[model samples]
Target chain A: MTDQTTNWPDHLTGDAQPLEVGILLYEGHTALDLVGPYTTFALAGMKVHLVAETLDPVVSDDGGMTIAPTTTFDDCPERLDILFVPGGGMVYKPMLDPATIAWLADRGATASYITAVCNGPLVLAAAGLLDGYRVATHWASRDQLARLGVEVSTERVCIDRNRFSGGGVTAGIDFGLTVVAHTLGEKAARFAQLVMEYDPEPPFNAGSPESAGPEIVALRTRFMAEPDTALRNAVSHVLEQRAATSSHPVSDENADPAAGIVND
Target chain B: MTDQTTNWPDHLTGDAQPLEVGILLYEGHTALDLVGPYTTFALAGMKVHLVAETLDPVVSDDGGMTIAPTTTFDDCPERLDILFVPGGGMVYKPMLDPATIAWLADRGATASYITAVCNGPLVLAAAGLLDGYRVATHWASRDQLARLGVEVSTERVCIDRNRFSGGGVTAGIDFGLTVVAHTLGEKAARFAQLVMEYDPEPPFNAGSPESAGPEIVALRTRFMAEPDTALRNAVSHVLEQRAATSSHPVSDENADPAAGIVND
Candidate 1:
């Protein structure tokens, strides 16, 4: 028997493993989008696996936190209480690749719950997992999500059943906490929140892409538009790929590493 | 002239050397307390150095984010803008260690600013920097600061001249953004905040030491009582250390690794 506290309930008749969480890591992804929730849920003692298309070290959106992934998408066990997705640079190839998108579309239906943080919901939209669901994406990409028939919101986090979304990188922490409460019940979640002391007080009180004054918002908006279009094109390709095949289109044997290297 | 964005005419400049941001690592430090801010600042493209009594990787309160120090107290540079103290675990020894406390005491006069997240201000208090300043620590540790003549507050972040304190670990991001604003201007800070999408909406809207339900709060209050005693004892020792020293007692002998242990 392991000595992990909460690992084993002394009175339970059958043995149970802690919920395994798989967080997707891709090149140029927002480190905060993943690290924020990674810290929150891991602190709550969930079994988290940082999974990537391959086991290579994934570079973050910025240049820091060069995280070497723990498992490839193919090798990760099928069981997961939550599948967390983090977004960063416009790495659209993974979502655009026919085989990869087919894999996401296949497993997503059977996964415990799937979530996207920041632009990560783009991947979900590509997988056809977000159709008709109210979702949230980063401010820059919200319109693109809307175009795909996903009910997009400006809220920090929007949850529609097993599909979850977050506004931007920082919102992932809150989204992670929300799921913690949803999965572990109030007591455990409350304890985890207290330990984190998750209340925020931004000095300038400006966070939204819109509310960040006119100039800065306009600048980022323009800079991000081109990349968004490119990503949208990629997702559209995947939607067509899913339509061509009714069976699970993605297979471990077919996930192409070349699907990496997009706008990032 | 460095090409770094922080080197702009509006930005502050010094040596062309790497921008040094020190995270004071100690045993039992909260993982996110340091990791959260570390991820943010590191992702911001800052040169982050984890400093400790010895260059051993420090273990966090939750045994997550085990990190090796880039240097030790002695080797840390003389001038720095961001001096981060992360809270959790046995802070008493490092706070009282003449080397660590003296280094802080000497630099406290010229540092760009000294900031603490969660109970970290206790270390600042140990150095006597918080004697007359308004400060905040982990909710449980506020009373401990009051005993040292610190004007304690319930605020998530208490920003006095050259001194910044947050309620606990999760406040690190907002505190970090606030520090960025103080160092840089509103525009740069806003850009960073926007890039990060600093929107925060928690799942249950409960994230304070006091905000958790009565049962969890009571349980935590009961659980923390014992550790708080250790913290008090450490505080007393630190006070004595300060009394024994005239001024600037910490040695800048160059950072040294702890004996018998090696960093990975």
Candidate 2:
């Protein structure tokens, strides 16, 4: 073990201003998606606020845990350094909620960095924040994101301008570190990684459909059929509203044929 | 992409019984440690209960988040398939609490699988459950575990008999999948992995002291000085009490010289 008394490098010890992070919390959102980044930012001395529609305890999708939100949408700070959204099984609920869409639009417009993990980009896309922007989301939800007019990337973490997104649940950790490296320098991100022991070793190589084989992928498709159907409906609703408000009527050249269709 | 209509293999869709998982929640506990495993097990179809001293919301160590426990210790099931603990900065408080230690001792005696992540093993050691058992804990807390008479292993996840212990905060996810693979079979674990997209790509290669370099390690040590000091004091208190009650007085041959001394 290294000596504990050794002086750290100046880069690692510089006094930096704390970042103001706002993480959105909705009923049935995945806990890991929110907690992964929350842990990373909090460990790096950032002030994180769990923002929700209300201040009540928000229950996760599995109904196994409840997390209390620190601030409500109406009360959250207007100018946030980072505004994040986490995805879950019932992610379509938020995508279809006008209030949630309005909140995302309002906060995302002024936030220095707009971010999401897993299917969270779907919410942002539905709120028109990801219009014509390159984004990443859960592999299973990529079709839905593409349907919403966002250029989807399958990379674990994707960054386009001020918008950052990660694929699936566990990718949030890597995404958080990437954000930290970008905002606070690589040294700060490395220090956070060390403290959290971010080294990973998956016992199996079936984390993705390409590696899990066709059989497992089919099983997941069967399990996710209902949610996929709901997402398709939600995407159609959002697109129709956008088209209706357009001054120019929808035309074959301008309209996307696959806008509402669920790609198999 | 694989066809969504493809039939899933019988081996992947077996009718398996859901495991009952009990996760301990406490004041000042790390959010990621608990949420990592909780998300894994829940996604795998396990019935998870966030067990705590009370049903009220438990505030995390960072003070930015609060998690609600589903069931109190007294109301928890008599026999759980898995009993889990998560570690954090204030882990010593639970280690020193007689009620918490007694509860762990009682539940651990009957639980089919006793497990923990991060410094959680320290509490198990304090309860005398880890006596003579090889365990894994956070690297920084190894000396404290040794003081409790438990043999420490540096592996990220260690399994001695039925006690499963993991390293630092993020190790909970890997440890959870290991437990799932053991109890539910590799197919189930692999499916869970796919669902959560557990593929990790760390932005930095600084997860351990050796990998993080001396400067980063020293920086962490400086940041952790106060917690380390408190942990040493707690270890000393537990050790002195154990020595006073021993009929055979503490001897050089039988006692650990490192006991009550914080190893730097």
Candidate 3:
């Protein structure tokens, strides 16, 4: 029963109830994308649920490892404080699955905060949840996300109103900390940060395209091509279906105001 | 079949056989500690296996999520290119388990490289693997690790010959990348970095005790006190058992030479 949150200072927790976080899990969802944020939320005394369609295990996109879901979509709490999604190779699979998209749409509508990392925003966009919010996603998927009618930012962590998005895989940690700061206060996030030892020293400076130089960037571009194309094609299909159902939604007036977006 | 490794430039992979990496998993291993490095190894075309005592789902220390192991201690390959362990609250459980220690001792003898992150080094040392090697662990457990007759370092990533270790939780990503650089090549590790978008921008500058400031450091110290004491007691018990079985092994003559250690 003793945990990092066991003797959480009353001043840090204040009157805040433990945030209920529902992280969507599906076939091929990347493990780190979910885990980085999950750790931050869990350590900060948030209730995180790995929400999947069934009780069956969800295999990661990386292959080999599988994570069991804590709750099924049907069994998840009707209202969540945070609705999160993680990106991966087959994110398109979930984007096209009506059941998954419907669940995302339903939960995202009332969730206090909508969050995602990497290509996760694409799934949110597919559900029409990110229509007017500027979000961040993996650099490789930014273009594709823009094609979904979602304004994409290049920052590692982007916050627009209640939408919190992170760029690529590791950015989930930063994104999660930012969310904790917003929800619980900077002190609580700092406590989680210390617990996680978030100080990073990447062996190489190739995390972003601009810094990775030409050769490495070209190689990663080639490597990401197929999956990128698949995601693009899936987004086009979603757009076409949306077009057929309803034309010209998410008006300029509905766009999240410029003041709400935090580029940092 | 097309993965990031598809068409991997011949020069990057060269004549290297895919690395066989076995990451230890137990009931309460931290998810990020495993996933961070697992992502790097998996992306670098390494055959990373989640090894456990049995094939059942292993719950994480943070709670909620459960990861299914790919191989059991009894079934894992006899020799591994890399043997890895992840840190968590209950790392002591594995450190005290004879079957797990025996298996690690068996594998560590011949693994091309032995690696750990966070308090994972304690588990490795408990198995009599890190004896005399300068290793790194979570800052909170550095004192505990040193008690196991292992030389400890404060660096985020420490490399002593074939022993590669890392600091707490998030440091696993950096540790894994370093291992990839040593095994495959720097270019290969760089490619994985780009694939992961490893750039980290912490919302707050409070990851290390040095930067976390005194107040946050105090909070984390208090939060970690119980677990730290438990690990210290476990390490003492392990040393007692080791002393009772074999008196004063790993002598000065057996110490890894100065040239083998990479402080950075």
By DockQ, the best candidate is 3
TM-score, chain B, predicted structure 1: 0.80
Query: Mind giving the per-residue lDDT tens digits that candidate 3 earns over B1-264?
Result: 112333345533444456688999998899999999999988877888899989989999867879999999989999898899999988989999999999999999888889999999989988989877899988878767766767778899998888999999999999999988877778778888988899889989999888989999898777667777778678778867876787664332113223233345
Q: What is the two-chain DockQ of model 3?
A: 0.67
Predictions' DockQ, in order? 0.39, 0.60, 0.67
lDDT of 1 by residue, A1-264 (tens): 133345322111225556678887777777678777887776555777777677666665545445567777788777667777788775585576555566676667677788988888878777778877878777777655665556777678777877877778888888888776666555656666776787777776567756687887775665456666777676556545655774754321113322211121
lDDT of 3 by residue, A110-213 (tens): 99899999999989999989978889989878767777768778899988999999999999999999998887778889989998899998988989888888
DockQ category of candidate 2: medium
- Tens digits of lDDT, candidate 2, A186-224: 777888898898888888888888898887788788877
Residue-wise lDDT of candidate 1 within B1-264, one digit each (tens)? 123445522222224344567778887877667766776565344567778778665565645444457787788787776888888866666666677777778767667778898888888888777766777677767666665557777777778777887777788887777666666545656766777788666776558745676776775665566667788778666555655774744221113212211111
Clashing residue pairs, candidate 2?
A: none
Q: Candidate 2: which stretches are off by over 4 Å? A: A1-16, A248-264, B1-17, B249-264
Best by lDDT: 3
Q: Please report, as a residue range, the 10-residue window in candidate 3 chain A with the lowest summed lDDT.
A: A250-259
Chain A TM-score, structure 2 = 0.88
lDDT accuracy of residue B264 in candidate 2: 25
The positional error of residue A251 in candidate 3, measured at the CA in angstroms, is: 14
